[model samples]
Target: MADGKFMTAAEAVALIRDGDTVGLMGGGGGLMEATHLFEAVQARFLATRAPRNLTVVHALGIGDKKTKGMSCFAHEGLVKRVIGGHWVWSPAMQQLALENRIEAYILPGGVSSQLMREIGAGRPGLISHVGLGTVCDPRHGGGRMNEAAKDDLAEVLTLDGREWLRYKPFPIHVALVRASAADEDGNISFEHEAANLDAPSLALAARNSGGRVIVQVAERLPRGALKAREVRIPSAWVDAIVVDPAQRTSYDIPFDPAFSGELTGTARAQSEAADHARELAAAQEAFGERQAVARRAAVELFNTGKARPVINYGVGVPDAVAKLIAARNEQHRIYQTIEHGTYGGTLMDGVLFGYARNATAMLDAATQFDFYGGGGLDVAFLGFGELDEEGSVNVSRLGGVTVGPGGFIDIAQNARKVVFCGTLAAKGVKLATGDGRLRVLQQGAVRKLVKRVDQITFSGPQGVVRGQQVLYLTERASFRLTPEGVELFEIAPGVDLQRDVLDQMDFMPRLAAEIGVMDAMYFTAALAAH
Candidate 1:
């Protein structure tokens, strides 16, 4: 961090070698913006004769197979492989990768973070009480990049007495991270930056692995300037530092006013709650339709005709779904119910849960995983994406590549019957049946469902084996994954089978049930595609 040692973003990046695994920092547009630094390094590597086998890692995004903004490495065919927990990878990244340009792998957020923790601890890998007997199971190799990834995941071994999911160890050589501020002594302070994203954990892991740790900061100071109490990252672990003084200008985050052109909100996520208050009000108009579907799905899931009703739920539709069950006096169809508690529900909360709602109880993250891993959760409802002829849904990766598995594998595995509540092929696409009564179009077309998913957020294999009926609720049609391709169940009124459904998709699906018309109240909101 000495003054004279400073170099341009391009100069510092030249230090990286080919095939080196670099740990990057910063998740969304925040204080730790590593994009510019990476771009500079990538450009240096690409403009000259460089090694193609480069590995990049980060808490949130390594931009997967494609890189954008400042990613000369991702663009010029310099990077060979990439990995991350969340997929916010650049969409064009995977296409080039699939074309043999780079190799990519996506892991669950929590699991991936934990993997880095295990590395820092010097353990080969950590055993998890999460994502077992589900899509992320090592048996399927955790949906690794390719043959090599399969081998990396193949090392996991489940303990017989107590069930848990385990993954192999990954070594680290270099790390690229960002910081809000740092002092000459190396005491770092996030100053509420911890909540920004997962940079701290990635940096710790990189340092513990004996790898060279390079950090990008907004400023540097004299020897005792920053207080020890304010330091987030200690100087002992820091190897090199690069400073970018301005807030968003020196490193612009497009979505943030602090960084970028006129455009904002990469996914409309930052300040989404405040910015889209009007949208939420509109979504409220369709509350009746959502509530009705929730009630029906809940009743069906509750009345199993056998066991005591113990239910578990997820966010979004499941929150509304649980409300229906509660309306029925916790019906005989249900006894004790649980939810991830993301919505403002006064229900029992579990561990690792964000608890956006005022739930009855909340516990440690570890305890939540215990219930999830123990296979005690009953029925659940959630969201999803495209299901191929093989029934593989690519809900994980998208064009912007902000794909994820977030606690999905854990919930799906424990639930008896999982209800995936989402519209199918949204974009004014519609279908009709039943003497022409109901009419509707698809809404919320997620971009992840391509010919193949960049990552598997949910596993169709487990759904089929568990007798799980996947319901894709669209205003126009309801599609379910069968042993064959996804089968269309019913269609809305004013919609045609031949014109709307079949025409949009690149592939054909099994026609299971004759399309039926939905109710009248469902047509107010026109379904739009992402």
Candidate 2:
């Protein structure tokens, strides 16, 4: 059962040469990350200063914000360029981009994953409508994050008389992927992983490009130990296998059968209960403004009137909708999904946002995005960093940081109904809610409702043209997107419309002909009743 394909993490990383375009496979919070390989590369570079000026490509953000995942390549000369779906996980990398040290570019997570397959197939590139009007569009900066990023990775072209964005492909000289186990012949299985991200595509891209595909696994099994059906990457495509017995399912979690879809039914329920208890204890003030916004957004799930609607919730306040739905015992009435491909489970928050506890099913990231791009989602609730007078939203490239839109563009552009959840003002906003009324204790200095957004992540005008339902939900008010712009139709109880709602915005929104007061239940502990 022995072969030269098996090696230590350092030996596997040593195969990477200088100036190679290395592809990494993982999602947020180090899910499925080849941690040992990344550590080896970082250590090797620090010790020998080899593999300098490399180009790093990742379909999703992979890090814990402090020091892991992409942050390992934060050194000035370690990486010359970066192309990723999201960037907030590694602040050090973001600083490199901010300082114009590295050529940084962002693309939608779905586009990046699918583009990998296109590269593997030796196709021209990915030509899709996923980012026709967003920042990825060539006309809209072409996904460049800084002046150092000079090349246009995306281009706008008309296909069949319809506009589409073509995300150019690049050769992946080295692909670093992770799985639960690898057989003696190098076949890989992700049986213990929470989600199978773009690992297969990355491996294929590397192999088809005549490059090396290095995979890190927790354990190594004898030949034929893994079933043919369980092997995600065939031995023929993998070049090196690194065994790290200490590999974890996620950064914060050592191991959880529910995350791998091995445990379900009553066991799953108990796991979800434990997670809810932990989150509730950690966020006792969750009943404040953010929860109120989530409460209103949750109502939209039922308003769709579908017997069982398929929905997605973005990170931040939008995640609260899942908790509210669980509180109402309405989990069975809707199918909740995450962009990273888990469905029907208690969605995790913070660094664990991509994985779900007790998920009923886990699809690979690309297949899930296919459903989303085809308008399979009945509704998608997303958090917004800025809302403009034209009803456009800006979640990417905000606050002087280049946090790319992971799946926000793919979900928002394709969902039948999109609800944006956030506070009217962001920094230092304080609110008190009780007895069916909300009081703004202190206003935030930053106004999220602006006349113009710094960048457009979701084009409201394009959404209106597509006839999609778009609504903005906040603690103080709710607005519906219209051809004329944002129309304020609902106001929170005990809030002065002019002082609390209008004054907080950089631009005035058109008032509805018959504005209504938000239901009092949203402001109180009886939110589940509604």
Candidate 3:
């Protein structure tokens, strides 16, 4: 404490005590991930096994879905419990949960992020309707993933004769956050990162609980290098800083200052644009039927007469929707947003899903979720791995793998309208598109539309109760979510309704009085343009 807050990752991690509740701050694609700090903790645990049975909390899917980030803490005795906002990126942890090796509880992204802020403010708990009728709801398993999870972390209460869900807050013993730079005084700034994410709230939560805040920074600066407004985490809230000088901007790229919007001069913008174009071109090479699904989803948005619609996109095919929108020169007509707080920019996909190719402005991750939880999104395009007769969607789990809903629940539930985009089936499904018509080369072995989804990430029945217009857009067909169930609304040409649609589904959907054919133009690569 006397020499300065700067320390090596191992030295900083030594402060974490056994049985401590550690709060982690990071989003998808390794954005603002304290990799060195996490690695140091893992190394220390393996060597000494001192900090055993620690409860870990994360607000998003961090890591590369393999051996990185929180996966380091997936050892049996190191982690006793996990309260996660998303689990898709951590397969090792999910495997532990499946084996009942650790207690696992999952909550919506907005709720978890807000819970940290409430904890910082010394609030009793977080009260919100973000997870009212979903798995996080007490009536629906209370967000528990396996039998080992037993605590009732959330409860349903009545206020003013209305129901609200309150998530109980726990004491934080350590907070690990990542930033772009930090002064020797431990003043943090995320000037070069894509988003600030949960760093601010995590630090505050640790400070309020009399815990230590360990930050990972790409660069260690002099005390006065950080401007007043740029200090995202104050020195008062920070306990130590670990500097990784060679830190890359994300998992894929080494460093791109244009992402931070700080070096967005004309020359830099042009260079970034060229690189973005090459990436887009490569992604489009494998578009295949994904193009049809994305175009159909985007057409629904383009048809809407609303001027400059406020739209948000999830990863996967939804990213294609953003590409189609930009290709059509309709980017200016809609205010595009990503859950990581980037707004009005070309949306990026893959490991860099939460970032933007070019952004107009960036806000705090919690503030972005506030807009989503408060019903600020007019339309949200999201990917679906599974959908059932009841219109429930499951992108969180499949075949023993748990990819938790990063921000899917918050965006899907709060948006005025929701479009679930994906293929009708997966795993070797083949189709050919030509002359504005599709030919079914082969049907997929896995039927995405089933009697019941393996897990309910987006509760369609809940969306119906909220009076939201929900649509499932697939390559071969489309369905509109009704209060009773899903109703078949459209089908692709050159496909048999019974063989390709009805027979493949586990449960029958209510057919529209006159089933409309999907626009023929959607069946070709031209859909991306015209």
lDDT of each: 0.52, 0.88, 0.84
Task: Give the worst 10-residue stretch by lDDT in candidate 3.
Answer: 278-287
Clashes in model 2: which pairs? none
Q: Of the candidates numbered 2 and 3, which has the greater lDDT value? A: 2
> Arrange candidates by TM-score, highest first: which order?
2, 3, 1
Error of 3 at 163 (Å): 1.6
The deviation in Å at residue 485 for candidate 3 is 1.5
> TM-scores of the models, in the given order?
0.63, 0.97, 0.96
What is the alpha-carbon lDDT of model 1 when measured against the actual structure? Answer: 0.52
Residue 173, candidate 1: Cα error in Å is 1.3
Error of 2 at 57 (Å): 0.9
The C-alpha RMSD of each candidate to the native structure, in angstroms, is 9.1, 1.9, 1.8
lDDT of 3 by residue, 1-530 (tens): 33578888888999999999999977767788888888899999999986899999988888888988779888999999998888877889999999999998887877778889999999988998887777777787688878999977789999998888999998899999888999877799988987778788888999999999998899989879989998998999999888898777887788876677665678666855675565456545644777888878987786556777789998888888887776655677888988878887666677777877658889877888999888788999999888998899987667856567778888998999999998888888888885577778888898888888877888988888899989999888899999889999899987889988888788999999999998887876644455
Q: How far is 524's C-alpha from truth in model 2 (Å)?
A: 1.1
Per-residue lDDT value at 310 in model 1: 52
